[model samples]
Target: MDVALVLIGLVGGVITALSPCILPVLPVIFLSGADRERRPYPVVAGLVLSFSLLTLLGAALLAALPLPPGTIRWAGLVALVLLGIGLIVPRFEAILEAPFARLPQARAGRDRGGFVLGLVLGTVYVPCAGPVLAAITIAGATGDIGAGTIALTAGFAVGTGLTLMVFALAGRAVSQRVAAFRRRQRAIRVASGVAVVLLALGLTFGVNVPNYATALDHEFQRLLPAHVPTGSDVPPALAECVGQALYTEPPDESQDCGPAPALTGITDWVGTPVTLAGLRGKVVLVDFWTFDCINCRHVIPHVEDWYAKYHAQGLEVIGVHTPEYSFEHEIAGVRRAVAREGITYPVAVDNDYGTWQAYGVQAWPSLFLVDAMGQVRHVAVGEGGYDETENLIRELLTTP
Candidate 1:
């Protein structure tokens, strides 16, 4: 990887540590090395290893598997809750510690316990790394799993690990100097546990801490004279056909279901004004998306690829820019987003939700495939199902 990319990853990792997503986990780092009898290096090593592996594997799995992001998020939430409960209740901690006790290293000093705790922490800690991490994950999703990608991901993990170790070692020193602090460690643990539970509740209720952190980062950068790159310049069209399994399985043929909805109440059109009637003789793919949504952004590359690949083969791809947030309703904002995202297909601005209501669209990044006869053939919501949608399109084009 280039030095610039590595540096970006390192900086991104440090920013992630400072983000609110990592706030709850800070106590864990502090406590990991709070016991002077325990060595922090083992815990730090475990954290680095687990986090780096998970980051790399998770990105690849997201690209290769039809795993729902919601499912993963919920699972992580559950883990956090359990950890928080364990921290608060002594009996619960003993119960949770049983599994770790089975490890051979558990017989050693508290260092082994620290290592095991680090492993669990690594699995559950979901820090928001903003644009740099976004670019890396995008590259992974687009099948850019090269040495450079691995190096960048590793560099991010290293940065995080190093910062955590610093906190842990400092905690160890403080514990050694202050005998009273060591005596009151249990109370501190309980407080930390409560904080973690509150954080979990916040995340469950859709409090986007990462976005807030990103905004702070932006403001901080503005104060500096030198322009700081947030990795937003990463290409928007880097997606390739990683595999078909990332989405749902394809249908054998396009089913002539019902009439397609018309594009109505469009304030502006990006490429050309497209009507269902006008696209009767062509295979059409309608994509519903908003600019601010991460899920929508991730799906854009695949949508763009489909357009580039099949536009010449009688496939008409139209993006319906549906507004999720209030800012997305502004035409200038939507236009700038379109330009930044490299969306060149016909985009009908659904400012009034007229088109959205007509199509009965309920989610961002929804897709509907229409046959040559203006019949809705296939549909997908959220992310994935690229292969199935593409297959349906190909089937419709070949038919008649």
Candidate 2:
């Protein structure tokens, strides 16, 4: 068990807990803390236990079982619905507690409820890929779930649990002592329950709440990827850069990976159909991304910022919108996400992974920096490298 990988995973998990990626499930986490009498320990513990197990063995388990895709996630949502109902109606809550009524510490308010909820929540909590997490995912995706991978997964699970545990504890303390919460305990409890149920419903219906924590997430990604050096060609400065790079050479002002792949097989076009040949003589930054991807969400804000600042200066940013899931392939969904993100640039919908495969994109939110000559100049995967990417764009735009 490499301790460094464990630490790297731990740090990445902590940052994820603080990232906008965690926004979707925050209501449930808060509710876990909202009950003043409930022990949040069991909830966090079960979350760690469940997450670690799922990360390491979920794919294999799914393959062996005849379960459909996302069965566990749906089960978690169902569990949340039940938990919310339990909170809203005290009778249901009593019934939920009935199974443990004869056990010792039956008077214990939290006893087993929180742990059960955590188990369910863990199944629903799908984390975005960061540097360390990408490795774990590759390991899982490739059927190489070894002991070392298990250790790293456990570290991430425990670290994520710790950050969330702090939030839950804080919520519980506030509920216990805060004047507003104390004044309307029952009403507040009911309101919190409603929020949880509504969140689950929203998730079930595929309604994505907009994220405001992108900038924070962007910063948090910087602290990840501190594992032991693998004698790769990554420069000392970029030693902590996101993931395994397609380019092992040092960053060059004139870095060209060869002529860029043509944008083809697009399902639909958002705004207008703009091709690479038409966009010649302009420095183009082709963003290979999907709407539902959390990393893509974080990356878009920065891309939007650049487009706004540099469009007139001859920077043409084209977003090749690829679908990571079935829902993301919908044109309406793509339009909604684009409008929601305030994206003004043209987005090409690549539902068939046509452009994705053409460019050999391995991850969501990949940036292919194309020079004015229509050649690929630089590439960035996952998150971070905001300043570096921006600087590269500046250099490319200014260069002949």
Candidate 3:
């Protein structure tokens, strides 16, 4: 295993925990073990195990398995629903905890079946990662798993697990501290149960409340590193390998990635249809995103700002709306998202993922800056490159 990549992955995972992409799942992670008697370690352990394995093998496994579309997601929702019910009903909760009652380790990790709860959450958990996770997902789906991939995946899981541990512990602390809450464990359990059920239902229906926690995410991105800074001691080849994935560097415009791929197989359009070829002689920002992704939601405002600020000056931002969930495939949802976000730029819905594959999109909230000459100038994957992207846009607009 390449230790450097693992380190990079570790860092990537920590930042992702702080990113807007994980915002939606933070509450679930926080409340997973909020009960005074439940331990957070086992839940986190289960979460890490599930996320790492699934990130590496989930796509290929899902495609190869005979299960119907969205089966795993549905099953996960059902599991959470049952777990929630177990919390709201004491007899059911006792029945659920009966199996883990005697085993010591289970007592610790599966206290109130926390491990199982984590496992269910992990199946549905979608956290945005730079090239670290994208590479793992591709490697997993394409059967190209290797030591480096495995190490990076492991490191990312560990980093994310660390943060999740903090949230879980915090929840436990808060639950124990307030005498009012401590005295009413049943009520606390009911509240936690209701949260779990709501989360499950939201995922079941692709219901997402955008702009949920932007300020917190802003602080995270503002303070954390987004990519490996320039002139690090890392090997040049290694840096280039993960360049598409970003590591937290001060943006440099000297990058020459390649030409932008043709935008194809877009089944619908929210504002209008646009092609890379037709968009020539213009500074184009192609944002690959889905409506339901939290990170994408966070990134949209910046895209809107840029489009509003630069559209008159030869800037064209095309939101290539891709689907991560089954419901995002519908145009009606896309329209609502666009309107809600107050986005006036064109949106291309690539339901078939043809455009996604065309650009080798590794994550939602990915952006490619194309110069008027129709050459790809810059790529920002997984949020947090606004200053650099904006500066580059200015340079491109003024230069050509």
Candidate 4:
């Protein structure tokens, strides 16, 4: 383990143990407990185990096991949907009633310790970190079970634990105010149930909203300078697509979007297909990225915005998710990535780096611009070329 990474894990753990979002749930878990002293410990343990289990599951998914992203997302969405339906529909209320109603017969007054508590808490407590945690876990599911999984699990546990510990400290206050908050609790339960349903529905269908991404891509173009260089140095036919900019020099060998790789598979979340060949009549910008890449995280918002603005104008934006880790392979993680980032364009997953190698991509955010003739145009290695790229896209879209 890298000593620095381990230290980072420890810090993440401590902070998670103290976060505000998770702290409030501790009291509820305690109140759900039949025993008093055993309250916080069990809940805390459950929450910890949940994080550990989910993290481990994530690591496993990254291994590219047969499990597909749609399956997991659908399963989780089903669970949340069922829970929500139980809350909203009186006829379906029996589902929620079963847990509370069967509590007496199920436990037989037996006390649940840390592990059991942890399981229950994890099962019930829906942390705001769901999407991020789910993405990490999905990534972990890809490669390296030994050190990578352990480190990721440890980091996740610490992050969640740090937020939960504060709840442990406030458990007593939470217990005392139970009665005064009963009405509020009921309302919360209803809201939570609805939220789960809504989230599931969004995951199932609403993942295609494209407003944010379109806006950001536009901002990138608008930021360009007034004058763009172009002339005899540039191809007469391709000059318009270059937007008055000359081919300053050959594209960097490292930034080259290697020969277009064979299309092994395609999963369309937005049903938009802007292939390398399809863009032969216009300019194309291919974004090589993964949902979990911290750098890609910042760039996606802009990518989405750019796609919406320039796509109709003949700029084809194809986001290739060449995941760096295993968890990124999960379709659910990809779907969440698209939804969370508000990406409306088409994305292809290169979990195996089949496409990554095809493009010879080596960075989180490598952009490849292909001219109207289908040859590589310009390439940007890292961040901070939004305006230049957008100008190129605009020029390409406007070309005859």
**Using TM-score as the measure, which candidate wins?**
3
Model 2, TM vs. native: 0.68
Per residue, candidate 2 scores C-alpha lDDT tens digits across 1-400 of 8776677678768867876666767776776677655677787777778776766666556657777545766777898888778878878977887786666653465657777767877776656655456456545534567767777787787689899999888888888878877677677568767876886787676555455554554455445454323224433323322233422322545454777778878989999889899988999999988776777877898999999999999999899987643335568888988898899999999866667656656556778888889877777876666787899999989988
- Residue pairs in steric clash, candidate 2? none
How do the candidates rank by lDDT, highest first? 3, 2, 1, 4
lDDT per residue as tens, model 1, 1-400? 6665566567667766665656657676776577444477876777677666655665456446666433444565676677678668868866766776767774463566556656656655665534455445445443456766676677688777788888888888888789876788787667656765765676554343322354454443233222222123222211110111112343455544467767777888877787889888998888888765555666788889988988999998999987543335567767777888899888998766667656655345667788888867776655555777777777777889
Q: Write the per-residue lDDT of candidate 4 for residues 1-400, one digit (tens) a residue.
A: 6443344444445433433333334334434332233345544666678656655664355245576544443454566567456545646755444444544332322223333434534543433222123224334444434564366457657656655655554544664567643445455445544654665565455333212232332233233332122112333333332332211222322222334433344544344655666556866777877764444666777778887777776677788876544335677778777888877778877665555544444345667777676666566644456777777667656656
- Given candidate 1, what's the lDDT at residue 134? 44
Model 4 ranges with Cα > 4 A deviation = 9-44, 58-139, 167-179, 182-283, 288-305, 311-314, 321-346, 351-353, 356-400
Report the backbone clash tally of model 3: 8
Q: Once model 3 is optimally superposed onto the true structure by TM-score, how far is the C-alpha of residue 45 displaced, in angstroms? A: 2.5
lDDT of each candidate versus the true structure: 0.64, 0.71, 0.72, 0.51
lDDT of 1 at 219: 40
Residue 42 shift from truth in candidate 3, angstroms: 2.8
| Residue 294 displacement (Å), model 3 | 2.0
RMSD of 1: 15.7
Q: Supply every candidate's count of residue pairs whose N, Cα or C atoms clash at under 3 angstroms.
A: 1, 0, 8, 42
Estimated TM-score for each candidate: 0.51, 0.68, 0.73, 0.50
Worst 10 residues of 3 by lDDT: 224-233
Report lDDT (Cα) of residue 112, candidate 1: 68
Which 10 consecutive residues of model 1 have the lowest summed lDDT?
237-246
